[model samples]
Target: MKLIIISGRSGSGKSTALQALEDVGFYCIDNLPAPLLPDLVNQILRDPDHPNKLAVSIDARNQHSNLKQFPDIYKRLRETRRLDCEVIYLDSSETTLLQRYSATRRKHPLSDDSQGLQQAISYEKQLLEPVSDLAAIRIDTTRLSLYELRDSIKLRVARRQEQELSLQFESFGYKHGIPLDVDFTFDVRCLPNPYWVPELRGYTGQEQPVIEFLEQQPEVQQMLADITGFLEKWLPLFEKNNRSYITVGIGCTGGQHRSVFLSERLAGHFRATMDNVQIRHRELN
Candidate 1:
């Protein structure tokens, strides 16, 4: 059986991710007690009618002591040769989490009259460290819309083949905060800026005009070659190390031109030799 453990702070889109998996036929449970994980697995394995894919959400709502015991429980689960388990931890910036709660007018799971929302958010981070440390994939959902988050959970988590690394090339604007989930970040701000050209300003890196402009710059080609070469040399090592996912962040002043173009080029290059390659232009969406 394949088990996916979904966890994160409140308002970080954990519910959306769990729902996405459930939509794809994963039998999902929300707010499951951390201590019951072993029992849950055993029960599922014994039942002939059990679903092959199981997803559960465990968060700060669980008992503090139970949450602290997660690491040992996870270690034992990993030792079970027949059971395949992956933990997907979702988080967002504190400000973003605050904004989400305010927008939705929902009560935080750990908030009360004595402890404010901000304090609860901060405390939850400390409380869930055990589970977060065991996560195979950490998703930062601060800038992702609900639809984008759903698509990401479906494509990056649900559709990924077992033991194959799900590699993602994401482009973003430096004006916006750097993505927290990326394993590596490349700054392309030093490269030529197509946004300066009046005609190309309106076009994105994916467009022919902007693409043509970037292709003509010698520096752009050199940067692409350098980044591509670096990944080519290192990616094999990560695969050999049994990595399940890798996210590379490429950023420019604005996501429209340089970063997006480079991300597209890199993804294309890796896709030629790798499976499960995906590209996302954050500002575009």
Candidate 2:
């Protein structure tokens, strides 16, 4: 059986992620008690009619003592021979979470007469630290739209095969702030700048003119080769460590040219040998 644990602070789109998994045929449960997890798994195993794909959402709504015991419970769940368990933690910036609450007019679960929304938001992070520390995948939803989040859950979680590693290459602009989810970040601002060229300034790296301009620069090719070689040497080690997913971030000045070009190149190179490789350009999206 495959078990996916969805967790995070409230208003971080945990419901959307659970729904996405449900849509893909996962038998999903929301706000399950942490201590009851072992019983749930045993029940599912005993029943042949029960779905093999199980997803459960565990969060601050549960009792404090139950949340504290999550690590020990999780350790035992992972030891179950027939079970494949993965935890996906979703989070957003404090400012974004505050804005979301203000826009929607929804009361936070932790807020009360003594606690304001901001205070509740801050406290919830501390309460959920035990679960967050064990997460295999962490997603920052500060900038992602609902559709984007749903697509991410579908592609990155639901579609991944058991025991397979999913690799993602994302390109972003340095000025916009680095992506919080990437495991590795490479800055390519030192390479040639297509934004300075008069004609290429109007096009992105995915376009033919910008692509042609970047292709001619020896510095760009050399950087791509070096980055590729580094990943080739170390990626197998990550796989050996049982990592389910890895994200590589490539950044340039505007995320329009160099970063996009190299991200596409790297994805192409890896896709030839790997079954699951995905690329996304943050600024372009």
Candidate 3:
């Protein structure tokens, strides 16, 4: 089994990271106390039908002060079980953590009458250093958006999947919002706003009327022509550069109409020719 121990500071998005792991198919346990790790691993190893990927979260909530216990447990587990273990350390700046605490209106785990959240955070950081240094992957969540963080975890998990060229196309609307996780963005407002047409306002480009309208417009034709040419020229280059995935985002005004249609069309285009492509309408109503 692949054992992943996710550890980090209190407000560094450890819960979010664990949820991301769970989303990607890992059997996840949240707030697992450090001292019980060895016994848990032993039980799992004894079960032949155990899950292939297992993730457990360890943090300040655990009363294990002997920081040395984690490495020792890991060494012993490695010797006994056919397990590959990796530690993922999630961390963020004190200022960001303080902001998170204030936003959530939650008291810090280590804070007391004399010490503030900042002080508590500092204390926890020192206490967790031994395990943090043992991490194979250390991620600073200070600047990471939730989607970006999830995508990062997915990328790591995807490494175990067969090595294949993958592409993800996402569609969104600027008014509803831009896709935060897009690697490349294309603005379709240049074509036409389907929102303007009273009849097509509620309909998406996946329908016949919207497709016919878009196909008739000179600008739409030109835009698709140019983008298709660009993809023909650049996709091979992306492969040459050793990229496993490329996300192309298409956006318009309202997510329900134009962007949805264009995204569907773009996905269909890639589906006919590309090797591996996953498409999602991020802001589709």
Candidate 4:
């Protein structure tokens, strides 16, 4: 059986992720007690018609002591060779979490009359530290829209098999800030810039003008080889340990040209070699 344990702070879109998993046919259970997990798995195993896929939603609402015991339970579950378990933790920036709570007018799970919203958010983060440490995949949902979040959960989470690694090569601009969820980030601002050319200033890396300009730069080829070689050497180590996701961020001064081209080239090369690969241009979108 394959189990996906979804845990996140309040308002970080765990509900949406659970919904997406359910839509994809996982039998989902919400707020399951940490102690009951073993029993549940055993019961499912005994049943003849049990769905092979299971998703469980866990959060800070569990008793304080129970939450502390989670790591041991998770360790035992992992020890059982019959089950393949992956933990996904979703997180957002404090500013984004505050904004979301304000927009929805919903009480945070940790908040009360004595606690301020910020205090509640901080406490929840501290409270969930054990589970956070065990997460095989961590997603930053601060910048995701409802549609994008749903799509990500469907594409990156539900679709990936237990043994498969979902890889993403993303392009971003330095001025905009780095992507929080990527496992590795490469800065390619030193490479030749298509923006220097008057005619290619407005075109993105996907366009022929920008692509041609970048293709002619020998430094760009060398950079790609170095980065690709490093990933090739280390990525299988992550996969062998059952990593569910790997995100590589490629950044330039502006996301429109060099970064986008390299991200495309790297993703294209790996897609043919890997099970699931994705490419995203953050600034371009």
Candidate 5:
């Protein structure tokens, strides 16, 4: 069975992700006990009409003692032959999480009589580190609207069926912090600065003007060629090692101009060569 374990902080949109997976025909479960995962897998395996796809959410409500055993359980599930397991970890900034809780007036799973919302958020992040560390895909939902988050869940999780490598390209600005979840990151800060031009400053890299400016730069082409060539040569090695996903990050001074241009271009090049290539602009989104 193809299994997807969706886990994250309380307000990071785990419920939304589970719903999206269900919409796409995954037999989805939420807040499953940490230890019961293997039993569930075994049950699915023993069934005559085996389920083709399964998704489960490991919530923060799980006992602290049980949470500590997650590492061993996650490792065992991954090693199981019949279980094609992929971990999707969702996260958001503390400020955003706080805002979400305040707006919705929802109590955090870890929050109680003694703990405040902020403390609970911090404590939950610490608590969830074991599963988060094993995550094949870490999605930072700090900027995503509910609609966009659902779309991302459908696009990323639903697309990877079984033993398939999903490739993603993310563009970010150096001004913002680097993305925590990526296999490779290429900083194209040396590329032509389209933001310097008054006409193109207002436009983003997806627009024709910014694209044209970056395309005209010889060094930008070289950087793209080198990065693409290296990935083309090494990607098969990762596949051989049983890797399921690879994220290529491209960054510039600002995500709006050069980095975004390169990301779109690189994704365009690889889309012809592979089935599951995706691109995300961190600053723009």
Candidate 6:
């Protein structure tokens, strides 16, 4: 059986995630008593008619009293059955969580009625830390829009089924700086400034005029040539290391022109040869 334990700090969108799982055909139960999880799993393992995908939510409602028993239960479950268990811990910033709770007008499960929301948030974070650490996947939902979260979950499910290497590119402006989380970064700031050219000032590299001008430059040609060869040589090593997603960032002085062009060109080139590729320009607009 495929068992997934979904837990998070009180207002981290666990309920929303559970709903998404249910929509995807998972047999999901929310706010399940932690102590019942072990027995539930055992019974399902013993039963031939049980659903293949089972998801359970555990949170502040029943977690504090039963939290201490989790480690042992995890160990016992792992030892007894041929089961694939995954823990998904959802997390969001305290401010975001507080807003979510206030917006919903729901009392915090751990709150002392008069306790400030921040204090309750702190307490829940501490309480959920252990199980969160044990989770195979941790999702930080602070900055994710609902659509983004839904798409992220869909990406995870698709990747699980395909087991293919995923490649992502985030193009950025040098003025805004390179994306902090990029695995690979390229500086196109040294190339000719398209911002200086009045014709290309408002137009993006995706346009034919920008492409034509960029193609006319020798430096642009040489850089893409070298970068492509370098990526082809090293991409296999990343795959061998079992990387799920590789993010490459291309940056230019303003991010409006050169980096945008190169990023698009590189994405097209890589997609033509590689298994999976996604590209985004952070300042293309």
Candidate with maximal lDDT: 2
Judged by TM-score relative to the true structure, which candidate is superior, 5 or 6?
5
Question: Of 3 and 6, which scores higher on TM-score?
Answer: 6
Q: Write the per-residue lDDT of candidate 5 for residues 1-285, one digit (tens) a residue.
A: 789999999999999999998998899889999899999999889998987899999968999888899999988998998678878999999999999999999888788899999999999999999889888888888878888888887877797656667889999998987876767989898877988889889999999988888888999999989999999999989888878788889989878888888899999999997888889998998
Q: How many backbone clashes does candidate 4 have?
A: 0
Q: Rate the local accuracy (lDDT) of all candidates.
A: 0.93, 0.94, 0.75, 0.90, 0.88, 0.76
Q: In order, what is each prediction's RMSD in angstroms?
A: 1.0, 0.9, 7.7, 1.5, 1.7, 4.7
Model 1 weakest lDDT span, ten residues long: 75-84
How do the residues 139-216 of candidate 4 rate in per-residue lDDT, one tens digit apiece? Answer: 888878777788888888888866898999989999888987889999999998889989999999999988888888
Kindly indicate the candidate among 1 and 5 with the higher TM-score: 1
Order the candidates by lDDT, highest first — what do you get? 2, 1, 4, 5, 6, 3
Residue-level lDDT of model 6, residues 180-200, one tens digit each, is 446789887788877788878
For candidate 3, the per-residue lDDT at 246 reads 68
lDDT of 1 at 281: 95
Error of 4 at 65 (Å): 1.4
TM-score of each: 0.97, 0.98, 0.56, 0.95, 0.94, 0.68
The best-first sequence of candidates by TM-score reads: 2, 1, 4, 5, 6, 3
lDDT of 4 at 153: 84
Flag clash pairs in model 6.
none
Q: Candidate 1 lDDT, tens digit per residue, 1-285? A: 889999999999998999999999999999999989988898888898888999999999999999999999998888875789989999999999999899889999899999999999999999999999988889999888989999999998899888888999999999987998999999999998988889889999999999999999999999999999999999889989988899999999978899999999999999998888999998998
**Where does model 5 exceed 4 Å of error?**
none
